[model samples]
Target chain A: QKEVEQDPGPLSVPEGAIVSLNCTYSNSAFQYFMWYRQYSRKGPELLMYTYSSGNKEDGRFTAQVDKSSKYISLFIRDSQPSDSATYLCAMKFNYGQNFVFGPGTRLSVLP
Target chain B: DAGVTQSPTHLIKTRGQQVTLRCSPKSGHDTVSWYQQALGQGPQFIFQYYEEEERQRGNFPDRFSGHQFPNYSSELNVNALLLGDSALYLCASSEYGIHTDTQYFGPGTRLTVL
Candidate 1:
């Protein structure tokens, strides 16, 4: 099985809608979970970062990690057209080592 | 200060050829790591360089090699590249080592193997 699994979603939603992106991992050793946003032809940018099993909120984005189930999620409230991009979930052990990445979910927020 | 910067924003090369991509880490940063991102896929770790020495490597073969200069600049060299080597090469810089450091990424160089 892949270390990290994420649905490659081209999920489309109207502006102002709430968006939920999720990823699951098989490795329980992963302690640092991160969400990255990537636009077309661009490099992935750090969006949200969380350690262990907890929730971290940054402005309109919230990252939740559940170590018990090895599940992670990124919730975007009040989505905007500019929010359209690929959302990737990455995870690593304590000090970042071989960060495994998910396939990324493609999201499009229409105006 | 400038963020991570990559040179040759885009390039096209034929199979069996060699290519070198460059990256300059963010100002005052020390560690540099490289990743390969294919179309519609997330970036995969290639390797990392710290203190001008190879620190960690991914599943990639020996054909994929890198070097870190004294100034914290880096170069990723692919020898005898294959068509599968076509991907976006990314460079991420961090202030400290990979452990417990937040990585800042460059714009990345898009490579096309023809």
Candidate 2:
């Protein structure tokens, strides 16, 4: 089994809607979880990160992690057309380890 | 305070060729990490360098290697490149263990192998 799993989605939603993207991992050692946004032909940008099992909110994005189940999520509120991009979930152990990324989910917020 | 910057924004090469991509980390950063992203996949960690040494590496083969200079800049070199090696190479930088949660990435170097 892959260490991380995420649905490859081209999820389409209308503007102003709420969207939720999730990923699950098999490793319990992963302590730091992160979400990244990438546009077409562009590099991935750090969206947000969380070390705890709860939620971390930044502007319109919220990242949630559940270490017990090894599940993580990124929720977007009032999604906009500019929010359309690929969302990647990545995680790592503590320091001194390279991060493992999940297959990203593509999102399109139609205006 | 520029973000991470990579050289030769795009490159095209043939099988059996060798290529080297460079990256300059963000100002004040000291650690550098490399990742590879295929056409439709998420970025995969290649390796990471700290203190001019490789601190960690991923599952990539020996054909892929890297170097980090004293300035915290890095280079990703591929030898005997294969078509499967075509991908976008990304460089990320952070302040060694202090601000790892905020590792920043460059625009990435798009490598094409024919």
Candidate 3:
């Protein structure tokens, strides 16, 4: 099984809708979790990162991690058209040199 | 402050050719990491460089290698390139070492191997 797994979604939602993207990992060693947004043909842009099983909130994005279940989520409130992009979940062990990333989910907030 | 910067922005190469992509880490950053992103997939870690030394590597083959300079810049070199090598090569930089959660990325180098 892959260490990190995420649904490859082409999820479409209307503008202003709340969107939730999730990822699950099998490794319990992961202590740092991150969410990134990628535009078409662009590089991954760091959205937010959390240290462990907790929640971190930004302006419009919220990242939640549940270490017990190895599940993490990114929720977007009042999504906008410009918010359309691919969301990737990444994690790594404490002091681990390399980060493992999920397959990513494509999101389109239509007007 | 300028974020991580990579070049050439785009490249096209034939199979069996070799290519070198460059990256300038974010100002005041000391670590650089490279990743490969293929169509419909997330970025996969290639390797990381710190203090002009190869710090860590991913599952990629030896054909994928890198170097770090004293200035905290980096390069990703692919030898005996295959069509499968066609993808976006990304460079990320961070002030701290591997444990830094604030790693930042460049725009990326898009490579097309024919």
Report every candidate's CA lDDT: 0.92, 0.91, 0.91
By summed lDDT, the worst window of 10 consecutive residues in model 2 chain B runs over B95-104
- For candidate 1, write residues B57-78 as lDDT tens digits: 9999999999999999999999
Worst 10 residues of 1 chain A by lDDT: A91-100
lDDT of 2: 0.91
TM-score, cand. 3 vs. native:
0.97
What is candidate 2's fraction of native contacts?
A: 0.65
TM-score of chain B of each: 0.96, 0.96, 0.95
Off by over 4 Å in 1: none
Model 2 C-alpha lDDT per residue in residues B1-114, reported as the tens digit of each score: 688999999999999999999999999988899999998988999999999999889889999999999888999999999999999999998887763546788999999999
Stretches off by above 4 angstroms in model 2 are: none
Docking class of 2: medium
TM for every model, in the order presented, reads 0.97, 0.97, 0.97
Q: Largest lDDT belongs to which candidate?
A: 1
Please list the residue runs of candidate 3 whose C-alpha ends up more than 4 Å from where it truly belongs after superposition: none
Q: Give me the displacement of residue A18 in model 3, in angstroms.
A: 0.5
Best-first order by DockQ = 1, 2, 3
- Number of the top candidate by DockQ? 1
Clashes of each: 1, 0, 0
